[model samples]
Target: MSSTEHTSLAPVEDDARLPVADPGLGEHVERYTDTDPAAARRAYRQVVTMFGLVPLLAIAFVVVYFAVPQDLWVPLLGTHWPLNNLLLGLTGGLAVLLVGLGAVHWARQLMSDHEMVEERHPATSDAATRAAFAEKVNAGVVDAGVSRRGMLLGSFGGALGILAVPALVTLADMGPWPTAAVRRETIEKTLWTEGEVVVNDVNAKPLRPEDLEIGQLVNAEPASLFDLNGHDYLTEKAKSALIVVRMDPNRIQIPESRRDWQVGGILAYSKICTHVGCPITLWEQQTHHVLCPCHQSTFDLGNSGVVVFGPAARSLPQLPLRVNAEGYLVAQSDFTVPVGPSFFERDSRNDYQEGDQ
Candidate 1:
């Protein structure tokens, strides 16, 4: 037969839509709790117990949040750890974890276990379908025994409600706004005071004029800084860190007002950069300029620590230096102005200028 005749002879089916055959759900397997009343009650207790722990953890989170100092450290596994953070994380994390676990346990062991199959339908629902869906939700809640199991419902609700407390209580840290007085008492203040001996930061020995040669720089800090421990030591050291540099007496400009501020052509400036409070470490001996490696802010130490280049808006704060009775370098007083980065409360007008005498 010809190919066209052969194709026409093939059987043809009608193009009418037909009803789909139902693929019934597979045989249901009964759970141990479904068959035994005692097992169901035991599951209820287990779920309730898990939910009950969440509230206790939440309370612990709050207690750890306030009672433990952030700086308090405890020895753990050969290293000191922040007790506040460790405890807070443990309590808060477990609180959330228990809530999730409790819900899962309740659904698996106690909720309706009958298998359900949803057939595809139109995306949009009519008013009747929507109303029916809401009724089904109410029925599902009843099947979960929410009304009958008051203890389970109460524990779950309490756990969920109290979980908000840890987050809310921490908001207290956002607080009363840093006033001028607060600035003076905290970040603006350092350990330096009159007669505080300058010490080599590396060796912790008091430094003298002879310890530094002309065109040489040494990183130093207040001798009193060594007396502090833990957070106090770290806080003070950040603000009190200094760099002592020396140049030829005839080579650098010394303002008449600051003539007595230096000792034998040696001077000291804050090791912190003004731009973003990075430590100033890189030094140029010939130019007498110290550079901040972070943003390349350069300060001319020979000319009152003026900003010769880069993004620093203010000069590196100079520390007034003098010789003590023991012939060691000592601070005349605290810095004339606050050091490090500027803040809203600071009086920038009082900051040292290049031409100020």
Candidate 2:
């Protein structure tokens, strides 16, 4: 069509509404870094320096791990510390943390800052429209000016490079090998060694077989806790804690091999819960069940301290008991198996070795 004919054919003002005028983008404001290239460069250098230092800190973490002996002590706040682990952890953590800070600073101070407009479109588009969108994204990158910012790019790269240091250092920190220190010292043994007298928790008095009545449940601990020498008060109390429960001898189901393990009708069990290691005292006298309040785990005192309910997967650990030369209640031996929750590498077969015996 001719231009004049096309103009004549176009809708007049009365037939069609005029399109809304574009408001255009907001007015651009120059940041301090934008106006001062020297200041921008300084900021970029500071970020790069932080990233560069991160790898050094990470290397220091590794050196501390190997060079510093685990048992060596350093005086701090009037207390001696085995500083190898602490120093390694701090240096490794700081290495990764500094890299993150450096990257954030580089992006905020030296990277490009601009605004652009994008026209909205329908959700579904044809193949040609999608290809055009990809080109627009590439154009957006040019507008962002990333390729022109050499200092910012360098700082970003350095920051990313340093982040690997902490990752490698942390792997070493995880372990040389698994340590069973806590299990061996705490769970496998208690205050109830052979010949240690059993003392009532309430009155701190030594108990005889006659002191307990049928269906009576008493909290007890090793007699060593009363002594001033040969043991620390806290350590003895933690390792030797126990609960003494007396029931009808006929109603008790003592294992065949453990028949003489109890003194009269009184049986002793570890106070530590088999669930999550809380001290369990909540008891049901009629059912001979002791319950843990922390997670509601219940154990049957009359049936080898077996777990009868709740989240506990194992029974409460049993302590062997006997009478001393003076006819007072005493421990026959320490707990045979580990107390508290089951661990990943726990020797279950060894634990159950004498179940039928």
| Cα lDDT tens digits for candidate 2, 1-357 | 866664436656842565666568979988788899898778767876887777688678778877888867789889886798679768877877887888677667765676668789899999999999899888766644457755555655665676675577568655445457756765566667889899987678999999899988889988778774432676566656788999988887888877888878799998888788888899788888999999999888888887778998877788888898999998888888887677786776644322556
Question: What is the lDDT, from 0 to 100, of the residue 137 in candidate 2?
Answer: 86
> Predicted candidate 2: what Cα RMSD to the true structure?
9.5
Highest-scoring model, lDDT? 1
User: Which candidate has the top score in TM-score?
Assistant: 1
In order of appearance, the predictions have TM-scores of 0.84, 0.65
Which 10-residue window in model 2 sums to the lowest lDDT?
348-357
Tell me the TM-score of model 2.
0.65
Q: How accurate is candidate 1 locally (lDDT)?
A: 0.90
Tell me the whole-model lDDT of each prediction, alpha carbons only: 0.90, 0.78
Residue-by-residue lDDT tens digits, candidate 1, 1-357: 866664435554443333555559989999998999999999999999988998899899898888998988999999999999999989999999999999998999899897989889899999999999999999999889898887988899998998999889878878656798878887788999999999999999999898889998999999988888987899899999999999998999999988998989999999999999999889999988889999999999999998999999998888999999999999999998899987767889977787998
